[model samples]
Target: MMSDENKVGTYPFVAEPFHVDFMERLTMGVLGNHLLNCAGFHAAERGFGIATLNENHYTWVLSRLAIEMEEMPRAYEKFSVQTWVENVYRLFTDRNFAILNQEGKPIGYARSIWAMISMETRKPADLLTLHGGSITDYVCQKDCPIAKPGRIKVEEQQALDEYKIRYSDIDLNGHVNSVKYIEHILDLFPMEWFRQKTVKRFEVAYVAESYYGDTLSFYRQQISENEFDIEVKKNGQEVVVRSKVIFN
Candidate 1:
């Protein structure tokens, strides 16, 4: 087994045309999806084998990711991504990742909290106990920022008008993935919408967990048409997720 100390490597990926948006920069979903792929590659380099998880009975699932982009990579640009394990918690492991241009200039950063879950029971297992040994000694730098999920409020009237979650919106975790939620909101508009418009800022908060069979009500209202407040609710109880999208 290659220890984490000897397991460092950089994964190079090209931003293909399919990965870019109308603005000619990487889409939020593609950026996140590629980051996960980078993490998988790094793990495989450590002899973990990218797709294999825990005796063929478990798999790694992304619980949450707090991603921040200083600037987006344009289409056809070559970027190098680096990932490393920071620490392991009881049910979740902390991983840190960074994206840089060909010249090594930083473009974005991301921190992911993931859980090792049983493929049979579909429930998470303790990270330290799953591999039947303590892997903490292999972790790299212990000093990584803790990116907690955020919180936002949705307007009552907007909640009443534009709120409803459909059956196809849920993911394997039984809740909507953060990136997919953004996609849903973006899909509400046409592709031409971005030619004269661009996302200046975007943020989301995962408030509570939702299950696969649960239908949610989505709510949103334009904040002067260029920005909007959005939320997902179940039975008008706890809000599952809240987000704000700003276009310039």
Candidate 2:
């Protein structure tokens, strides 16, 4: 709903080769996630500037993100992307984004949740306080109609694929970057299927740690035309992460 005309300029489109390593691409996905948040803050500042609480107090932090890519963008390819507010609920606000090619076809889309924080205490603040304005007014009718992240019941699936953890997947926080879970999930799909359908909603819970040299087996099954459940296990024994991805 917000416009570049009313705010700062749009994100810069860069043409570069795509990273080949799955883990590296995952990191870029996480970076893209952060970049969209920065864009949202720019929009907020354009409309509300600095929202004063009582004294000097205000900040925004990402609380959660749910996004779906029809296909993962290759390393270093040029792509154009844009983001805007979708809606805000209570203390959480939703942001929507689109990734396009040079020809202007959609490559991927995402929805993320953000929350207001107190600069001093690092605690959450109400949506009414930020005054970023109404999200519905800014929601883009063209791409804003995507379905909500659906819920799926977990069921066991045949073990069909495996991947070994590499040092690059680890982040400074000493854990795999959350987006790596997405890469592992996509690894279960054949290239043909991915080319035909795009992911709709990707939700994950990292259950355990995976170390270098560990082989993780992927288990997955389709629940509908637009949804599936995916899990990664260590050597057929321990579960590392479980996720549900909806496609359209």
Candidate 3:
């Protein structure tokens, strides 16, 4: 286990068979999950994890994430994820992560923004108000190499599929989990695409919340041979999430 005194934590993981796609490479959703898990584990060790925050009637929520990978790891590949807080604001905090191969070289990086929300009102909570002024002092200066994710432009695209929210998709927030959204978007592509192309970069900005029983419409548009845009909406016009995926 990595220590918390340095303000950075490292967690080891293996790309198990379940973590891979049909192509036997790590799936985007699983990679995102591993990054978040690393962040959560570090936060817990530092006394501000979701469990600790729950005691204070607050929980962390992901706002946006951008990930860029040199290449996806294959099944049974061993890797280490290092995560640290890059910056902390009033309502949100920015965290950066590095995915390293067995040789300890970075194969990918990601940046994510998160907010703490009150369990009672479901409103944003101030970091200072929750943990006092000292919490902000424990930040790591290490920066992510990739740029932060921005708002995705939704263009005119045809609906690809309609999916109904299932019980498994909802998280403790009573809405669909963030990673599930990525899974839904990835499902739009056929198995052949996953075998031929590799995801070089993936960005997602969650907009509105989708609840159980609500049907989401998935849309896709090709930006280029290696780039694509995706959007999810509950109705025809109400957007739930927007994302862009770049493949190599």
- Candidate closest to the true structure, highest TM-score: 3
Local accuracy by lDDT, each model? 0.68, 0.60, 0.87
- Model 1 stretches with alpha carbons more than 4 Å out: 1-7, 47-50, 142-148, 151-179, 187-216, 221-229, 233-248
* Candidate 1 vs candidate 2, lDDT winner: 1
lDDT of candidate 2 vs native? 0.60
- Best lDDT among the predictions, by candidate number: 3
Cα lDDT for residue 243, model 2?
72
Q: What TM-score number comes out for model 2?
A: 0.58
lDDT of 3 at 10: 88
Stretches of model 3 off by over 4 angstroms after superposition? 1-5
TM-score preference between candidates 1 and 2, better one: 1
Clashes of 3: 0
Mind giving the per-residue lDDT tens digits that candidate 2 earns over 125-213?
A: 77754554443355444464455544444576677787777888775446565567666776666756555665556766556667767
Per-residue lDDT of model 3, residues 1-248, tens digit only: 23454788889999999989877888899999998889899899888999998998998888888999997788999989998888888888989999999889999999998998998998999886677745576676775778788667767568989999999999877999989999998888887887788889999888889999999998888889988889999967689899999988
The estimated TM-scores of all candidates read: 0.71, 0.58, 0.93
